[model samples]
Target: DPMVMAMLVDKMQEACQHLDRLQVRISDTRSSVLVTGDLNAGKSTFVNAILNREVVPDDQQPCTALFCEVKSVDQNDGVEEVHAIRDPEAYRRDDPTTFERLSLAHLRTVVEDNEPGYEMLKIYCRDAHGKSDSLLHNGALDISLIDSPGLNIDSMKTMALFAQQEEIDVIVFVVNAENHFTLSGREFLRTAGKEKAYLFIVVNRFDQIRRKDRCKRDVLDQIRDISPRTYAEAEHLVHFVSARKTLLNGLARSPSPMARGAMLEPASEADLADFKHLERCLRQFILEKRARSKLAPAHVYLSHLLSDLRVLLAYNAQRSARALQRLDGQRSQNEARALQLAKLRETVLDRLDDTIADTAQRVADDAERHLNRFLDHLHHIPYDVTYHGMMYLWRYADDLYRAITMRMNGLAAHIQTEAIRLSSAASSVSTVVAPPSSVSSSATTLAHRDTLGAGNVPALPELLDRAALARMARGLLPGLGALAVGLVGYARSLVAPMGAGAAASHALVTAAKRPNPLARGAFGTLAFAGTLMLFYVVADFRRPLEQQLCRAVGTHLRRTGWVRRHADATGRRAARALRQGLWRFQSDFARIQAEEAVLATQWSRERDACQQRGQRITAMTTRVAEITEQLEAINLDT
Candidate 1:
């Protein structure tokens, strides 16, 4: 089953070449079988037992100090072989002076960086060194073994990495029989079981406790209470063994019979039987894992991968928003304005084109004759008519620039005047109302602006208030007033549907009883007072919306005249300066070249004399600074 899954992972890794290969390093190859536990909880020993090997290095030290991988290797002619993955130690070395290349090589290398004391698990084992030529024979099942660093204090990195790779095939948790259950151990089990891996609770060195009366059984029961998942999985499958003894027995079995006397554990028959049973159970569990792997292919994990990807997308989006917030929000407003201007230009083409054509023709006609007369006179001169022609060009350019600027300023003023006229007409029905205090400064600026003796200025008529403008708009569009009335009545009905009718009936009855024409008119207005209240409510809500519309219209008006003029002025200035400078430089070409030759000769002579000092550039700078300081002090004294 592992074979099938491994093949699938291989194909996926091949297809994802466009993405950086580093993404594949963690999840590629095969499902990692993370063998983790306490220092002497038989993690390394358990790995060796499952692989049927006596090669994993083991010691009695608190930290065993190496992360090893026993993977299938390849030989010529389709022979299957096991090879130990080797690379530089990915840990803090005894010699701490050099740390430049402390970790293992990059992800592409055989062994990845798994620095000791860091809560990461790293072991990459492949059967072959190259691509799989034959999926049947030469193809070797690849399995990553994650031997985690000690877990006295939970490392956030370790927790995150484990959470990321929650598709673990099997969790081999080794518990030492002698030690009591610890908080760290319980925490590890709780997290490990939740990952949905097949849990295996192994009691290492069970031979020491198996002989005591109910001692081994008591410890096993405690483990069951602590790890329900592990206990359930082990109901039909649990292993207890002295790994060191097993390793020695398997390796030294064919050795001289006397050499076997020094086995790591007691030489009791029961100890031998325990080790043998433990070995069989461990083998069966691995087989079960392999079977599961075959039953569910690698695509089964794609759903989890996609889920993690969505979370990552959300994280990145938030990160970008925060980054932009730090960069200054004013730029965002400028960008939005630019986009709006672009969209408006597409719809306002005919108006913009006509304006541009009119401005260009008028400006050119006004300046052309003056420029031609000057050029004609210059051509008659004998000493380089080209120079005179250039001067004529510069003057003509300046005249054109001035005419264009005037046209643009005139256009902008005309647009603003028309806008004010429309605003005036809308507000012509009632007396003027003062604008809000917040707009007082703008109002003052408008009042003080000098208007020429023309009919463009708006008269300060009585009907200049918001209410007057609304009434005028209603006269222009009948349904607009009706819509306002309906919306208000709808909202009122929601609040007091029955009481609203009673109030209306009372007002109508009072209006019907009125006799005098003026009094009847007053009563009729009073009868519709509720409707006026609703109209005011809608009017107040529409103020902000009106301001936005006015602003947008004003921006379009400003761009129509201001932007064209600005572009024209800029282009004219650049053209004029270049033409004039080119003319002047050519007219005095000989004289300027003669002067530059003299200056160059003098500069070279001084430079040669200074070069004899042979001082370093840095020293010369220091000396100059020192001299400047002394000179400053002398000036101060004087």
Candidate 2:
């Protein structure tokens, strides 16, 4: 983006600097006039008439092959000089000098040699009285008159040479009135007329026309038809002139007629008037054309600079829009990731909860079964008999304790496993939710339970002291009493309980008194076993032992509860971590959104500036067009 900004600034500066330089150059430029025509079109005669000297040769055959530059000299002595400039190689080969001074009378003879080295002919002439006083008489600025080769022989080459010159203020296209507009002449007009130059189409040799008025009208019509762009609606651009007549009149008025035989007939006033009108038109057009030419380059430079500015503005706007689009797309992605992380947190926590519930339930069921078996074994041991019975109960209690511990450990392991899984899930989600810099690699390490098997598991029997254990044992005494009462009622119902209570008591005593030996033995054994069971059930050893088993089972349940609690804690921690990560991501997204807002504001400002510049360019372009139109609409008026 900075690069783009730099490029935009550079382009703007470049265009502006170029326009400034062009304006400066245009301000100091000099105006020039190029005179061109077909072969034998009196172009040379026209130039000679303007200079009041035969600087350019007017012969039967084509004489001038190179461009001739006619400049006014500040020689009050009236001594005109003709200087010939030769090409370097040609001058080196034939003559050592690049410049050759020629006599004014022999200027045509030397230039007509058509030497290969001839580059240009410079004629420094002092204007004769009343001769050079017309048309090209600007006060200070010296307007050089350029005469080029005939367009018919090498029109492309000739036009190419003329096109190289700068600031062409006026173009005097001399065409023979007898031939009007030739194909080559009209083509040259089309090519040269497109330049920012005031065109004056002079029909030379007007004396050749038989019917002057009719021929003049026909010639003007022909000029309009042939070169409509040069003559269309600007009838003043077309002028009928007799350069030969004007030259003859100048010679006749000369102190010594240089060409005595050239003036066989005196020049008519009408012919003189035609020359004067042509001169006046040239003067008016040249003055205005020079003034407009000064502003032409400024107009062109503004147009070019405006065009470049518009293109640069469009490019910058497109780049800014693309950048904004990319930012918006990234913001959307961040938001989506945040939402996904949130969902993952919910899912992981729910799954951990389910795992904890299932595991806790299984461990609880196992502990309950172990406690039931221990209690049932205690019911079978006789209390009034041997010490071995007590030993057996203690041994069973120890086994139950071990079993409960193992189960609790297993439950802890399960919870740990679930915690690890939840942590892993959270870690995976973190990769997507948080940026790389914010993601913690050790986030899931809390799930590693290195202390579970190293005696850190909560022991069942150790949870309560002797007093607490004795209190819990006393708390179970009511349930034990109820069980003993129920057992006595079951024994009575099995013996006799169908009749009344007194009758059942009498029957039971009679059966005991008349017992046979085998019946006696069997009844005695049965009574002994029942009495032992009853005594054992009511012994203090059974109570204490039952309390021990209850403590072990309670301890196991507490341990499993710890596991569940750990699992819950782990789940909550992981969920909280995920939420925190998600929050960070959201925070980052918010920051990005804020940055985007700032960038958007900047983009809006740049767009406004671009729009304003575009509007200015449009206005300036319209102004340039108006100025161009005004320049084109300029004529001999203002």
Candidate 3:
């Protein structure tokens, strides 16, 4: 696309260059008349006859290889000077950078030498005609004549280039009366006709052509075929003259290709009269018909320039329009994508919140239900805890409490781990909650981030409190409450203490046969009380102790809400870890959305720029169209 744009710029530059040259040409009222013909067809002679000076040299060989422009000295501040222009487009009469100043005396040598590099030569000289005698003296317009190289097969293209210049108001196609129109002459006329269709056709050396009528007819016939429009106005546009006679009466005599003779008395006056008439007609054509002569060439060139520029501008406009369209589409798409990403991140985070809360509730409920069931099952499992007599029953109670604590702790751990996996599964639909892109493989990335690391995953909250353990251990003995009073009373009033103590008490009673009854009763009661205290210290009520310990543990766990509290803690901890990951995802997602928004802004600007470019292209195209329309109107009016 850049290459295409560059190419368009280059073409526009060329158009601008052409406009520059046109500005220079139309800047003044001076009209340029080009005298071009076949090789040595007296083109230089005709130019001299017009200026009435031989400043432009004529040679047997191709002398005027380059364009030799002749200007009156009065136009150059009344000074005679010559300039050789190397680059005509940049040529300025006073600018040293543009042209090389030459000696006026060497005008003949400069014109005849035909320098290799220079394409244009300017000659400023004093013409032979005085103020009222010449059109150059007219205040209305300034006129200059250019003598071009003789038309040849090799130089035809170059001559064509010169003749079609924007300032060339008139074309003088001088034909040698003896030879008529040569192939080169015909070809030049045919091509030049496209712009300057009406040319001043001059048949020079007419006096030497004895068969003048046939020569005139033959030239007119060639004119009709080359330019019918010019031939139709032959009386005004065509002429037959003796440039040699005019020349003999004009500049210095120099040996040339054409043979020279003494002035003959017979046709001298006729030749002079005809040459004079040609001069008069040329002046009238330049002054009276200045509009067609001056403006037509420029109009022709301007029309073509506008046509080319129109094509170029129209092409650029279409491309700009399409570019604007594409930019709009891309900008819109980026904006929509940014919006979508924003919404998706919010939705994912919301779902994660619900999942975490729901998981905590489920974990709490499962822990409460499963733990209570285990305690209930313990009521029917008496054979498992071996009752090693009522003496070691208290040891057995300690063992039972330890066993329940370990089982509950293990179950709480299992509940925590199960909560992690199920919570992860519940929120699996939200992939954005995954890790912070640190996982090496996709397989583990989701599972890894949704749950905590292995070290933290299966950890249970503290489940078994010391208070519950102490309560269960104390269950193997009687309470220090009113239950202790009832046990001692039952031992004192209802049961014998021990068989040895009873036999000892009987022997003592037999020895002191009729001692005091109060004393005897008191002794027997003290022995019984002592025995009861020792027996109660090591009671072996295994079945009742086991049930009581299990009941206390279950009661402690429920009353304190121990299992549910720990399970909820575990679930909430896992949720916080997952929520943190989701927060990271939200940050990353928002960053991406922000970047996309920036891109969309840039695209929108570019789209606006393209639209403005299309508008500019349209403006340029319109200007060109207006210029073309004006030229057409002028041509029609002319």
Candidate 4:
């Protein structure tokens, strides 16, 4: 949208270029005077008076619709010609009277008929006898008198034709003295008054007023009251002149008396003097005030153009600034969101790792406590060296294995609980990190499991097998060692008592009255040696058997290591699943960040373009201001 506006501004710049060229041509032409007023205001009659000839028709009905240009030419033959030059170049030529001549009577017929085909009529004349030398004397600039159509009736059509003409140097507003400043006349004055042109308000037919001085004073006062700005002062702006008297006086001054009497009207010396003064004022304005007249129109056009351009440029700059500001705000919001997501990603990952580690540690500690309790129960059982004792030990080992298996399953459930928590966390945070469409059902569905009972908890694969339980049972060896020590102590207590009884019976049976001391001493020494040997054998077998029991216990309990391995495997699996979900979230977040980066870059480029456009507008505004200042500084009065 702004691009289209930029194109419009460019077109305006081009239009200004054309205006500059038109202004140059305007400055080169003779100062033009456009005569305007309401119907029967004596506008055409006033033009005829100024030219000192009855060229423009003046009648009761409307006559002139097209503009008429009258210029003085150097013609010794005293011939006058009128041409309807539609071509614009004709106005530039000194002698544009080369076209077909239309009689004054035929021109009157065309005006009365109201023919719209003709654009303008050019009349070329010269003073062969130099009768009106004071008016168009030497050193006086050539003047073009343009008579416009009547106002208030068919005003639009009339004004449309007037707009087609070039710069108007002066406006001669002719008002009938009898009516003075009609509604239509005031409206026309207000419209034309704004132009930078010399305005002259003439109260035509002053001779008709019964009290000339009073009527003229009242008319001047009324004009000032209506529009004071139309002229510098009442005296300078108002003129009282009878067009009939002025025309008749000029005719009387003709070289041939017969020609003068034929056209002259009856007029008093006072009417003649008033006409003379009006003529002198007009002549001075056309000559002495020439510079002001030419520059005024140009000054007005440039000033207005510059002012409009300044307003348009200011509006464009403000619009551009507002657009850039909105873009910047959006970019900031996007950046903040991206940062928030990044931080969330880090926090979620950290929490997930901590949860997994804590779950694993709890499972390991639980398995160890269960194994220790099973070993304590096994240690207190009676030792039978027979097959029955061995069967009992195997049964105890099997029961312990079942308990470890159940504990490992509980650990698996705990791990699943933690995994579900992680999945729900990922699901909830996924909505924040990415769109809902990106989340997989598997990851999100886990959160719904919270509403279900324990029976609804999905079954997990076995964590501990027989081999794993056996590994866990290895830690029960110290209890088995204590069992071996008890067996050794029982055997020592029974054997020590029996050995003493048999040795005492053997001594009684083998004893002689007074007994051979050496023989008896040898028997007693041998019996004592046998008893010490038995004790030594039992003591020596105790440590070896205890070591054997420890080995057996270690072999059975080693199966429990399978449970630890299963827990580790389950933890790895869960961690992997959680990691996969986290990775998906991370991937989505990364893409979001990338998209934000592109958007930020796009906004930055647009902002830069707006800034450049603003700079250009500022530069153009400065140039326009400088041109306005130069136009204002020109001394048109001098």
Query: Per-model C-alpha lDDT, please?
Result: 0.43, 0.59, 0.67, 0.60
Ranking of predictions according to TM-score: 4, 3, 2, 1
Task: Provide TM-scores for the models.
Answer: 0.34, 0.51, 0.55, 0.63
For candidate 2, give the lDDT.
Answer: 0.59
Per-residue accuracy of model 4 over 262-373 as CA lDDT, tens digit each: 5545777777777767766766666666665666656666677788888988998898888878887887887788788668767665475674455445544444444344
Q: lDDT of model 4 at residue 429? A: 62
Q: Output the worst ten-in-a-row residue range by lDDT, candidate 3.
A: 437-446
- Candidate 2 lDDT, 39-71, residue by residue in tens: 878778788787666567777678777777676
User: Between the candidate structures 1 and 4, which one is better when assessed by TM-score?
Assistant: 4
Candidate 1 structure, TM-score to reference: 0.34
What RMSD does each model have against the real structure?
38.5, 12.7, 13.1, 13.3
- Model 2, residue pairs in steric clash: none
Regions more than 4 Å wrong, model 4: 1-18, 74-79, 85-99, 114-117, 127-140, 152-156, 211-228, 253-266, 320-417, 424-573
Model 3, 20-40: lDDT tens digits are 766776676788888878777
Clashes of each: 7, 0, 1, 18
Top-lDDT structure, candidate number: 3
TM-score of 4: 0.63
Order the candidates by lDDT, highest first. Answer: 3, 4, 2, 1
